[model samples]
Target: MRKIVHIDMDAFYASVEQRDDPSLRGRPVVVAWRGKRSVVCAASYEARRFGVRSAMPAITAERLCPEAVFVPPDFGRYKAVSRQVREIFLRHTDLVEPLSLDEAYLDVTRNKTGLPTATRVAKTIRQQIRDETQLNASAGVAPAKFLAKIASDWKKPNGLFVIQPHEVLDFLAPLSVARIPGVGKVMEAKLARYGIRSVGDLRSWDIFELERRFGRYGLRLHELAHGIDHSEVKPDRPVQSISAEDTFDIDRFRDELGPAIRQLAEKAWQATRKTERLARTVVLKLKTDQFKIYTRSITPGDSINNVDEVSALALLLLQRVELPADTRYRLVGVGLSNFYEPGQLGGQTELFGNEF
Candidate 1:
């Protein structure tokens, strides 16, 4: 069994705000744009106590905690801190897979420091992060990625937990089905209809029966109920897509997206050029104020030429949105995908072109 560790920074954006501004310490802090359509980026534990949360509208958050201090997100500073934390992880193991700016998975089964166990590595890394950045990180050590991810979140705000191979089943049993990753509100409701409320309940059902109901996911459910996950901590995965997006301070009508689309396309074009890979497709994405998502993609007859083309294509796709008249959107995004390394660019795949 491999020894995996999941490290998650606690209330990352909000914590950084509090750390930088001592006055915000121990007070409800929300990182968000201040407007009717703006959504919370991160909420401190103090803010969460008043029901404020990430993605909640700023208006709702204001109603929840009138005294909550709001600060705009500073991604540049967060990315810098993330790099420092990653350097600390590299001291122990090279098998690091970052999930976001605030969390990552490390396969420390064979660590460079010659640590006797994964728990020691987790503790040492957490302490180093605290000492270097003055921020708290929680850790979870387990034999598999799934278990490690769950264990890391078991305790929050400077806590650590472990899940031994022998205790896997015992640890998974009796827990709510929602504890499983990917079991969102919709999936939980679907499982509830079949009287499956816990991991134990899931295990009691026949594997074939699960497959019959949930298809491929049902087999995954059976394995997870028994605490089995074979996925590895993949490091240095190739870039499959490059994207940039913006959320408007106020919801926008269809006619208002041209400028945003052009801006995002320029941002995406610049971002993609920084990589060794070239894009073969363009994608347009939009999200309504009600959270409805829509994506339109085109592979085109050839690879993208410039930002102007991307803007034109994105605008064309915008016209294809089949929503009702006068529908409003809160977010717009543009991206490039179907990437091929520069060395692989001149290939027969260009003749037929790929469809996204």
Candidate 2:
């Protein structure tokens, strides 16, 4: 059986804020803007007691908890801490796949640190993160990524849970059908209407009947309900594309557009740097207040070398959007696509000083 470990930091952003600022510890904290158009990005456990949650509007969050402390996100500091946690992960296994800034999957079947079990490796990594960054982490160890991910969330902040091969079925059977990935609120309600609440209920459905009702996802749900996930831990996953997106508090000024594009380019560059590939196409994504999405892309003559090139290409694409300066926007994003390895082309040297 394959050994996979999922590590997820507890209340990542809010935890970091509390760790850095001693005064904020143990108090209800919400990391978000205190503006009319802003939404909560993350809420500490204390804040969650008052029904505060991520993505909820700031006004609603205030109504839920009048005493809640609100703080804006600091991506730079969070990225630095994420890197520190990544370094801790690297010490044990090279087969690390980061799902986001605060969560990742590590295949430690044969670890570099000579760890005997995946659980041991998880314990050591969690301890190291706490020692180095003063942050708490939760971990789950199982034979597959899906189970490991769910196990990790079994217990909150500073918890470690393991699902051995023998216990997989029993552990999964009692869980709600909504625990399966991709089964959102709508699907859960649909399942509930049929008196199917848990994985056990899903197991009672015939495969053909599930396929008839829900199509391809039904098959996946059937397999997941039985604790079967065949996905492998890919150590050398290739980068298909690089992108950056931001949801603005409000529409930005036309003159202020340059700064926002530059900022997004920097973010895209940072995201691309995590991979070992070069991109030839740059794409810009814009979303208006009405939720209409628009995209424009250009394949540059040469591979994009730095943030400056990305910014320039993005600005050029922005001109294609017919919207006027006063057009209110809800979101903006920049991306790089059409990737290739640096040495894949004959004698094509690195175009820019930036290396992925």
- Per-residue lDDT for 1-356 in model 1, tens only? 78999999999889988998999999999988687645677899999999998767777999999999999877667767777888898899888876666778899988999888999899999999999999999999999898998898899878999998888899999999998878987799999999999999999999999999999999999988998889998774556788988888899999988877876776676555434456888899999989999999988877787667888888899989989768999999998999876556631111000000
- Candidate 2, poorest ten consecutive residues by summed lDDT: 347-356
lDDT of each: 0.83, 0.82
RMSD for each model, in Å, please?
A: 8.7, 8.3
Q: Of the candidates shown, which would achieve the greatest TM-score relative to the real structure?
A: 1
| Candidate 1 lowest-lDDT run of ten | 347-356
Q: What TM-score goes with each of the models?
A: 0.75, 0.70
TM-score of 2: 0.70
Off by over 4 Å in 2: 235-356
